[model samples]
Target: MHEQESTRLGDEIVRLVRMGARFRGMFKTGDLGAEFSALMLLPPLRAMGPMRVTDLAEFKQADPSTVSRQAAQLVKAGLARREADPADGRASRLAVTEAGVQACERVREARAAMLERALADWPAERITAFTDLFEEFNHAVEALLRTDPTTPPREPA
Candidate 1:
């Protein structure tokens, strides 16, 4: 890409991210409450089964303290539980509860429905093309973040 095109793309990505955050805030699941920040931790915990705060922080490229606080919220909400780490009796790992799984599904369905309504006028082929391109863009960004030592850890915007 040319320098100008790269600059434009970067700007658009920033705008898209900001808009997405706003849209996410609009989604309210009864199980998780209206605060989406803490709920973000559920997906990784759900996927990884159980993980220490530090491990989850590293996986998410977020601060360990932040992850710890979020995990606590999950625990308080009964969406997740802390369990003894099999390898280390002294340490505990956070695991998503069955409620957490259901909450995640609800959130996913809500988001999908919203997207479907928003894209109702778009052709199926266009939607598929956009999805493919968006996934490619996300993978490229992840690769850059992984390889670039100078890249800073992500924080809530």
Candidate 2:
């Protein structure tokens, strides 16, 4: 890619990221009646099965204590529960509860509805092409994160 094209691409990506951050806050409509920040832990716990706070922190590249507190909130909200780790009786793993799964689905539905409306004017072919390209882009980014010494693992999109 030309230098100018590369710069433009970077700028556009940054703009989209900022917009995504904004959209993140817009979904907090009390669908789950829990703190939005705490609920942020649901998806990972759901996807990862059961995990320790330390493991969650490592995967998120965040502080262990912070993740522990967040997980505690999830437990308090009944979104997640603590399960005894079979390998370590002293340690507990966090697992998403049925309520958490339902909440996750509701949130996803809202997000998908919003995205559908946002792209309502786009042609079907354009949408299909964008989906394919976006998936490829995300895979390339994940590959770079795995191989690049300076790149860090991030939560999936």
Candidate 3:
């Protein structure tokens, strides 16, 4: 094996290890038990605009009924709502409400606080670079998956 290839793989391993540790620390802070389905739903809803329940199921790689149930819970909690879809009269799209947006912001702020505490000793430049690189990686992976779902470039050998 090439020495350079070995070093690159080692760097990626280190990054993954650090990321897992940071996520563990964040979860430890919110005694919200082991279930954080609400938190998980928040980011995806924030990223994707209003979508039909079926669409949400597809995006989440989940069953339609599960997605519908979760989305219904979100609506009942006032975090999300069902709106008539203009394109399809018989269907509805689930969208986060104003209150939902506020809730999302709060959750994000708390997570950011956790991250800040974890990386307090790191230089600002290093943190910024890490964020940039992570987003770039996310984009690359998203593109790869969209192009071919059968195989992603980052899968383990």
Worst lDDT 10-window in candidate 2: 28-37
Predictions in order: lDDT: 0.83, 0.81, 0.71
State which candidate, 2 or 3, has the greater TM-score: 2
Where does model 3 exceed 4 Å of error? 1-35, 43-49, 58-65, 152-157
TM-score (C-alpha, index-matched) for candidate 3: 0.68
Q: Write the per-residue lDDT of candidate 1 for residues 70-92, one digit (tens) a residue.
A: 88888888888999999999999
Which one wins on TM-score? 1
Candidate 2 per-residue C-alpha lDDT over 19-101 given as tens digits, one digit per residue, 9 for 90 to 100 = 97678667644657576666777788888889988888877666777787888887888888999999999999999999989
Would you give me the overall lDDT of model 2? 0.81
List ranges where model 2 is wrong by over 4 Å: 28-37, 61-63, 152-157
What digit string (tens of lDDT, one per residue) describes model 3 on residues 24-97?
Answer: 45643343321245445656787887888777776766667767777777787787888899999888898888
Predicted structure with the largest lDDT when compared to the true one:
1
Sort by lDDT, best first.
1, 2, 3
| Candidate 2 pairs with clashing backbones | none
Scanning candidate 3 in windows of ten residues, the lowest lDDT window is: 27-36
